[model samples]
Target: MDPNIQGGSYDNPSQAACAHGHYGVAKLLLERGADPFSQGGRFTNALQAALFSESEAIVKLLLEKGVDPNPGNTLQVVAYYGFEAIVTLLLDDGADLNIQDKTHRNALHEAAMQGSEAIVNLLLERGTDPNIQGGAFGSALQAATYHNREAIVKLLLEKGADPNFQDVQGGLFGNALQAAALRGSGSIVKLLLEKGVDPNVQGGRYGNAITAAACNNCWWDDGREVVTRLLLDYGAILSDAP
Candidate 1:
């Protein structure tokens, strides 16, 4: 049988084996010269398939076979799922931390959005920039804030994340302040305010923090009012809201 013969639900045998965590089969196929870099299936390649399976052994086998760990922004995907072990493996293999996907989101942004504190800490300790802009939530701080990951939000702020930083790519909430306001995260909004975030820094779907607060649907009217009041107290300009 040709080792590289492509077929089946996964488009390739090696990818199927890796995706299903059939470690022994994946090893056998690789030893028989199956192309580890063959792209298909739900994942981009065998290495990514291994990641989906959470099989560190198969990941190591693919890496040893010289598969690109960073293929298809693999680091970002791993961070999104909060796979700390695999993330460490990729980083130790020298995967590019700065690589962003179509949304311009790096691994750190995914980690923050997923509320993966350990992964966020790991990325930060390894020099991942907290203030990288773009993606659905702008910066990692904004992602954490919007998702109501208070601990991650505090951690990002402690790691020197810029409170007033706005995404040049024009994210939905513009900045962390706006994101927190829209989510009705009063604690997070207060934290950002204390950090000196400019409540009126414009340029997002809602234009400014006050508008985002006005659009809050956090299921708690009091929470929205709290966030709105917090924004106002922090010098949010009502006239700046669109």
Candidate 2:
């Protein structure tokens, strides 16, 4: 224990215990009237620090003691590290599955953005909206597609994510097919194509996935060839006009 926190307020003891994964010290502090939710210094609280450290034991202890697992800091840490176990614990404890962060990104969005397939599946199993939007980058599908997470994309598709859904920007910017093409994820593109994603769906500066791939130079050689052939096979029209 740090000398500064040894004799400090109840908040300090719990915070220090959480930081160091001192479950016994944390329990002691809580038993001695420490508020597990207290925030001080750089530490948001015992629960937040435990989640940050990926200390499953400490997190379970805090949850058992009734800490707010849905607190912004707790959610942030869970989302940042893709802690599938902690996420499950928090959900079982009734953490808000749709609680958004400062940027309006919920835990689902975070998991998808990081391409954590396990976390994504867990969130979806718990009824998290696959199409929840409002992140800096938009929906969870957009995050997965942009990152070229083919597994996540396939999972989201299986879970009924709207591949044709647009973002809050009022355009088709977040379309899964467009993102896959933009990133040169040919496998994802092929999956989307097979799923009946419109071959000519207009999005961003380009009119469709093929155009987007062509314009963004997503495929240098064989990637371009595959994308073009796939689009042509799907009846995508190519024109000289902008």
Error of 1 at 44 (Å): 3.3
lDDT of 2 by residue, 10-86 (tens): 24777777877888877887877777767664565677778656788889998998888787646645865888888
Candidate 2 similarity to native, TM-score: 0.85
Root-mean-square deviation of every model: 1.9, 3.4
- Runs of candidate 2 exceeding 4 Å displacement: 1-11, 170-172, 205-207, 216-222, 240-242
Clash totals for all models, in order? 0, 0
Model 2 steric clash total: 0
lDDT of 1 at 240: 68
Candidate 1's C-alpha runs over 4 A off are 216-222
Residue-by-residue lDDT tens digits, candidate 1, 86-178? 899899888998798876889999999999999999999999887877588878888898889999999998998988887877677777887
